[model samples]
Target chain A: DAMVIQNPRYQVTQFGKPVTLSCSQTLNHNVMYWYQQKSSQAPKLLFHYYDKDFNNEADTPDNFQSRRPNTSFCFLDIRSPGLGDAAMYLCATSRTARDEKLFFGSGTQLSVL
Target chain B: QQQVKQSPQSLIVQKGGISIINCAYENTAFDYFPWYQQFPGKGPALLIAIRPDVSEKKEGRFTISFNKSAKQFSLHIMDSQPGDSATYFCAPLSGSARQLTFGSGTQLTVLP
Candidate 1:
């Protein structure tokens, strides 16, 4: 099935260490998004790629960065992991920018220790 | 401003009962509303959606009741079952890129 896939379902990283999460999609959607979700809170948009153009949320931290190497692959890089950065990282894709529904991946559960 | 607000952090319902989750949004420009269901360790899936031009929409056992004038929308799951237990989120989309503003989320448990 055409779907979004994330690598390393569970990731454990040492404090201040760098970690990278990957997402790939078979659906070939035009828009890809990254979101950070802590326990019981809404998923916060970190950044997204429209084709190859990157859009970052105003409040996203500097430690968080993303790259869309190509149409089907996107990566989230944490410059320095912190305890507060432990959360589920979700990747999603949509066909277009207007009123389009997103399809999400299972998510990477990051644990910063 | 936190554009969206959701109620009932958690809810418990017996099998075959009705499950309702509510959300309100502050953005009047929001034209699209969607409800997503998330299972443990899984990503959220689109359950149903509605537009401000419509008051309600139903798909199978899921329904979205939208009150455009009030800036509120709700999801109603009919004949709820254990399989329906999941986290429910209501979101409104607007502006360029149509970025979604989501509610905090409500965890629903349907006892079998």
Candidate 2:
């Protein structure tokens, strides 16, 4: 089945330490996105890569960055993990920029101690 | 800015009952609206969706009612079961460059 996959289901990091979450997709979707979801809350868009063009949400802090090495893989990097940054980081991909149906990976649960 | 709002942050229903979730949106970027279901410790899965051109769409016990004029839509789950308990999110997509803008989410608990 064509699906999105994320590595390290649970990640623990010290405050101020940096961490990276990995994502890969077999769906070959051109648009990959990263979202932050806190407990019982909505998933907030952090940024996305539509092909090679990166689109970042205005309110997304400078601490979060993303890299799409190719069409099938994407990575999210936290320059400095903060306590408030502890949440589920979800990786999703759609067929195209106009495609709204997203396939999401099982997410990396980040814990910043 | 696009904002999706959902009501009833949490709901409790008995098996064989119907579960209803309402949503309203502001500044919708596209006509497509979808509901995602997420279980504990799992990624969200697409449950159902509707387009503005249609008033209602149904697959099995799940139904989606769309009201374009009111900028509102809803998901109706018939014959609610314990297995159906999960968090539901109302997300309208194509917003901010064709991405989903998800609502806060409603935790549904269906008791047997």
Candidate 3:
């Protein structure tokens, strides 16, 4: 099954510590996206990569960054974890920009203590 | 301003009843509307989608009724079951950016 996969389904990090979340896809899609979803709220788009071209959302915090070294792998790096940063991080992929359906990974539940 | 607004933060329906979730969007440029279903501790999955050009689209027991003039779209789950209990989200995708702006989401519980 061609699907999106995320590593470390549950992550625990100390305050102000740096952490990285990973996502890989067998779908080989060109566009990869990272979203932060808090409890009972909509998933907020952090950034996305269009085959190595990074596009960050205007309101995304400076502490959040993403990297897509190749077509299949993307990583989300948190420069400094905060208690407010505890949320589910979702990874999604799509083949094209125009009305294409997004495939999402199970997500990484980050806990900042 | 929130581009999309969803109604009824939560809903409870009996099994075999109808489940309806509604959403309204402020962006007139949005051409694509999609509904995603999310389970606890999991990512949202695309359940169904519709385009502004069409008034309605149906797949299996799920139906999306889109009112382009009103800038509102809704999802109707027919013959709801316990397995259908999950969070439902409605999103509208802007045509130019193809980026989706989602609603707050509605948690639906279907009692068996």
Candidate 4:
């Protein structure tokens, strides 16, 4: 089935260490997004790639960064992991930035120790 | 101020009963209202969505009642079952930004 996929479903990193979460899709969607969802909270958009155009949320911390080398792949890099950074990282895609619907991946659960 | 507000931070519903989740939003250039269901350790899945022009849209057991004038919308799950339990979020878009903003989220538990 063509779907969004995230690797390392569960990740553990030491405090202040760098970590990377990955996402890929077979959907061939041009818009890819990264969301951070904490316990009992809604998913928060960190940044997104609208066909190579990187749009970052104003509130997103500098520690969080994303890269989309191509249409099928995207990556989230944490410059320095913190306890507060531990959360489920979700990847989503849309055929176009204006489309109303989204396709999501299972998510990468990060644990900062 | 939160752009989108969803009610009943959490809910417990019996099997075969109706599960209703409500959300209200401040008017903007927003055009799409989407409801998502997320299971533990998983990403959210789009259950159903509605446009401001429509009052209601239904799919199978799920229904979205959108009141554009009142700036509110709701999700009604009919004949709820245990497998229907999940966290729901109402993320309305400002045409297309940051998902515009996300609702706090509601955790639903359907008892079997």
Candidate 5:
């Protein structure tokens, strides 16, 4: 089945340490997105890649960065993990950067100690 | 300001009952609305969606009621079951950017 896959279902990082979460998709979607969801809250948009162009949300912190090496792979890098950064990170893909259904991975839970 | 607002942060319903979750959006540019369901420790999956041009769309027991004039939409689960217990989020899709603005989410529990 074509779907989104995220590596390291659970991750633990020390404070100020750098951590990376990865996502891959077999859907061959042109648009990929990263979302941060805290406990009992909505998933907030961090950034997304439309084809190869990186689009960052205005409120996204500088500590968070994203990279799309190719259409099938995208990476989320946290330069300095803070305690508040601990949450579930979700990766989603869509056929286009317009109104369309999204395919999401199981998600990676980050715990900053 | 939050672009999307959802109500009734939590709800409990009996099996065979009806479950309703409501959401409102302030963005007029939003022409697409989708509802996602997420279970514990899993990512959200698309359940049902509705376009502003239509007032309602249904798939099996899941239904989406959209009101373009009111800028609101709702998800209704018919004959709710224990397996239907999960968190539901209403997200509005807007622009060529396709960035989805999600509501806070509603946690629904269906007791058997």
Candidate 6:
């Protein structure tokens, strides 16, 4: 089945260390997104890539960055992991920018020690 | 600031009962409203959505009642079951942005 896939379901990083989370999609979606979800909270949009164009949320921290090498893969890089940065990072994809239905991966749980 | 406000942070319902989750949004420009269901250790998946032009949308036992004038929407789960237990979020979409503005979320627990 065509779906979103995230690598390293669980990740542990030390403070100030850099870590990367990856996502790949077989759905052939044109839009890819990254969201940060804390315990008992809503998933917050970090950034997204519409085809090759990158769109970042205004309140997203500078430490978070994303790269979309191509349509099938997108990566999230944390420049310097902080204790507060520990959360579940989710990756999602949609057929188009206007499409309402989003297919999400299982998600990567990041633990910043 | 929470663009959408969801009531009853958590709820418990018995099997065969009805579970209702309510949300209110301040953005009048939001034309698309979607509800997502998330299980433990998993990402949220879109369950159902309703456009402002419609008053309600239903799929199986799940229903979304939308009120454009009041800027309030709700999700109703009929004959709630244990498998239906999960966290539900209200995310509204505005034309200005391609992404969604999510509400705080509500945890639903259906006991058998």
Please give the DockQ score of every candidate, comma-separated: 0.84, 0.84, 0.83, 0.76, 0.84, 0.87
* Model 2 spans with C-alpha error above 4 angstroms: B94-96
2 versus 4: better TM-score goes to:
4
Cα lDDT of model 5 by residue, A56-113, tens digit: 9999999999999999999999999999999999999999876378888999999999
Query: Which regions of candidate 1 are displaced past 4 Å?
Result: none
lDDT of 4 by residue, A29-87 (tens): 98999999999989888888889999988999999988888889999999999999999
Candidate 1: residue B87 lDDT (0-100): 97
Specify the poorest-scoring 10-residue window by lDDT in model 4 chain A.
Answer: A94-103
- The residue-by-residue lDDT of candidate 2 on A1-113, one tens digit each, is 63999999999999999999999999988899899999988888999988999999999999999999899889999999999999999999889888878888999999999
lDDT of 3 by residue, B55-87 (tens): 999999999999888889999999999999999
| Residue B16, candidate 1: C-alpha displacement in angstroms | 0.7
lDDT of 6 by residue, A45-105 (tens): 9999999999998999999999999999999999999999999999999999988788999
The fraction of reference interface contacts (C-alpha pairs within 8 A across chains A and B) present in each candidate is 0.88, 0.82, 0.85, 0.82, 0.91, 0.91
- Candidate 3 Cα deviation (angstroms), residue A35: 0.1
Chain A alone, model 5, TM-score? 0.97
Q: Clashing residue pairs, candidate 3?
A: none
Look at candidate 4 and tell me the lDDT of residue A64: 94
Residue B65, candidate 5: Cα error in Å is 1.3
Query: Which window of ten consecutive residues has the lowest lDDT sum in model 1 chain A?
Result: A94-103
Candidate order by DockQ, decreasing, is 6, 2, 5, 1, 3, 4
What's the distance in Å from true for residue A87, model 1? 0.4
TM-score of the A chain in candidate 1: the value is 0.97
Inter-residue clash pairs, candidate 1: none
Give the whole-model CA lDDT for all candidates, comma-separated. 0.92, 0.91, 0.92, 0.90, 0.93, 0.93
